[model samples]
Target: MPRTKGNHEARRRDVSEAVWRVLVAHGFGGLTMRAVAAELDATTGLLTHYFPAKRDLVAYALDLLERRSASRPRRAAGKGLSAVRAALLDILPLTDEATDSNRIWVSSWDAALANPELSDDYARKYAKSREKLRDLVAAAQQLGELPDGDPARIAAGAQSFVLGLVVQALFDPPAFPSHRQAELLDDYLATLNSPPSSGGDHEILS
Candidate 1:
């Protein structure tokens, strides 16, 4: 008898779980077919049936990461700068799970930078994230919570700050614990409240 759609979906979920385990344990560099097979306690043939090539598996893994990130719980919805702060905090590696996810993302950078298609894909993802942040920044400015400036530029700066902090926290967790990360983020946000310098609104390249 032919398998039902539910069966196919269950099998895919199983595969995705196995892939996530492998990614969290060893990053993309160690995401071999054998490793995933062992993680799933299944044969390589099974994986090959789902992913004919290693690249296919890698692509699926990346997609899984994006899906998981999008589904993560967000802080209570608010408006203006408070909402912006909540959104930015969600990106920081302040929890164990967030730290692991950040590690996986940082590990994927090498693979993404090497392949043109993956590079473009990552670029688009970052752009989309920045766009969301830009909207928040614009709202905050409108509410007088932040000083006037180009929302896109402000958003880009915020994104860069969060990402840089993520890298630092990943590399030196001892130096940048969760509280420290939050404190630093608050400090950065505080600066946004300052009026633009007399010279002019400082140019911030997006």
Candidate 2:
């Protein structure tokens, strides 16, 4: 008998979680249906039941990572600037789970450079994340909580700074602690609130 779609989806979630475990513990190259099946104590047939193709598995994993990555920050939206900062930190690869997700994303982005098929998805997600940050910064500005900088540019710059922090953590361990990150975020927010130069047109919101 043909299985129902919901059943497949349920299994897909299970399989996806298993894949996350493997990808976190090992890299993408180390991921396999067999490994995931064993991790879940299931069979390859069952794993295939959810993720029949490796690409399907990768796509699912990426979607999960993106959704989970964005959730916290979005929730923190109404709380205030501090909430927004907290959300941004949730996206970084500092902790074990975040590190795994970030590792997969970074590696996938590198692979996308040579793989035309994956480039669009990578670019789309990257742009969306940047836009989200921009929006959050704009919100802060609208509240008159931030200083006199251009929100668009300031948001982009802030995103760049956070990205640098994350990349630095990957290269140099023990330097991206949460408390330090919070301080860095506060510093960045303070910069955004700085005075704009004289006679500058700063009504832009892109």
Candidate 3:
């Protein structure tokens, strides 16, 4: 039977999803084409028709993960610090789905270490993500929910904290449960949301 372009693309999408499942089940180390094929109950030959190399399959899986991360539903939480908090919470591994995504993301960091292209791409992505966090902090300050501070520094610190928290949540889920992570994040943000200082130069954290 002749394969149409539409069918081919559909098959590629299925293969990519299988890759995601493999990643979720076994992390990056288990994302081989054969493993994905096994997850799909298909053959390696079929996957090879879509992804010639393992790197291509891995890259496509990462791209799909990023798209899924961006498409998560986010609440407005009104304006001011609440808005910033809402945005930050949306990035955490709060849900089962989010936990899987975070696990894959953490595993991908190691994979990216050997793949310069993926590393550079993620570097840009992380920077953009941090910029959004920075903007949220600045917006909260402008709305008088937070004290005046270097928005860039605040955002950078927040980003660093979130990254570390995510790792802990992934590996030590018992200790850093979702609610605990939220409590810590909210508590830290609360410290920054003090009454605006007269000097207008208060640091984000003491």
Q: Which candidate is the best by lDDT?
A: 1
For model 1, how does the per-residue alpha-carbon lDDT over 11-76 read when each residue is reduced to its tens digit?
889999999989988999999999999998999998899999998999899998888899988899
Using lDDT as the yardstick, the better of models 2 and 3 is: 3
Per-candidate TM-scores read: 0.90, 0.73, 0.87
Score each candidate by Cα lDDT: 0.93, 0.70, 0.84
Q: Clashing pairs in model 1?
A: none
Taking the candidates one at a time, how many backbone clashes does each contain? Answer: 0, 1, 0
**Per-residue alpha-carbon lDDT of candidate 3 for residues 137-190, written as tens digits (9 for 90 to 100):** 888889888888898888888888888889999988899899999999998898
Candidate 3 residue runs with Cα over 4 Å from true position: 1-10, 195-206
Where is the poorest 10-residue window by lDDT in model 2? 71-80
Local lDDT at 186 for model 1: 98
Best by TM-score: 1
The TM-score of candidate 2 is: 0.73
Q: Which tens-of-lDDT digit does each residue in 87-156 have in candidate 2?
A: 5676666576666667766655655777786788777866777787777767776777666456667667
Candidate 1 lDDT score at position 4 = 98
